[model samples]
Target: MKRLAPHSPATLACTMLLALASQTTPAAARDADKPRPVVDFTSCAKPAWPKADLAARHSGTVTLSFNIDSQGKADAGTVVKSSGHAGLDEAARSGIAKCRFKNGPGAVQMQYVWVTE
Candidate 1:
């Protein structure tokens, strides 16, 4: 009777490769939570500057924290920080709501900056 060699070089290599492929590395998992529908601020049309604030040369940053659901849509979160201008704050929220993410079920925060030159 012939016994199977479980430790054969070829067999061992195949097993190791399989194990590695099936296991998710920490780095991979960490990077897995990526935004979908890709947030391209460069392409995002700039929101209109509030007339009153614009005239005064107001500039500020709004930080928003939100959840990305399974469908990759922003689940309507809140502004973690305000930009001191209602218009800027609302604009930041509006743009965020339009975003979609992938590998989510987690929190996402973004900052929107407004400046008048």
Candidate 2:
């Protein structure tokens, strides 16, 4: 079977959403009012679908929350919500950690939804 491409619309959309969020307003301004630091996802690492899951056509969503350092790197990610499949949850967690965001506070959220075609 042909392996699924690493970059999917879901990943691209999520990354784009992050980028747009970062570009919308100044982090300093956001920090003044919002308790959570606004993060701008400037970079992305696409999540890989497990071979077994892909073969089985499994699908789910993972909600990830993590801290972004002042340097705009993801750190200390937690699975806010599981994707049901361990592989998907792990992939999303790893992927979220690889994401790059604008320098701000530590709190940030990212949701990864996987849908089989």
Candidate 3:
């Protein structure tokens, strides 16, 4: 009868092979567990004074901070920064509300910019 020793080469080779196999298996894939935000801009309606502003005059960017729940729904967020115009800010928020993310667990910060043409 022969007894196998723990430090034998056969034992080491078997252990290494098991570790390699586990690493290559797709079942071990890890899902992203971080927070992220999805952002988008809504098409601006014709400006009241398009003739004077030419779209560029009222063009500006707004920054919004929001939390995405595990289900990937955009929770009502705060307007961290504004484009100095109430209309533009509202537009940005409206666009953000329409955006959706994948079904997962995470959160993110995003910015939406609106420009006049």
TM, every model: 0.58, 0.66, 0.49
Please list all clashing residue pairs in model 1, or write none if there are none.
none
Off by over 4 Å in 1: 1-45
Tens digits of per-residue lDDT, candidate 2, 15-65, equal: 212212222346536665554444444466567767777666668877777
Clashes of 1: 0
Question: How many clashes show up in model 2?
Answer: 0
Which pairs of residues collide in model 2?
none
Best candidate, TM-score: 2
Cα RMSD of all models vs. native, in order, equals 23.6, 7.0, 26.0
lDDT of 1 by residue, 3-109 (tens): 53544443222100000011144643686655323343443455555666655556788777766667666676687789888876886677667765555555666
- Candidate with the greatest lDDT versus the true structure: 2
Sorted on TM-score, best first, the list reads: 2, 1, 3
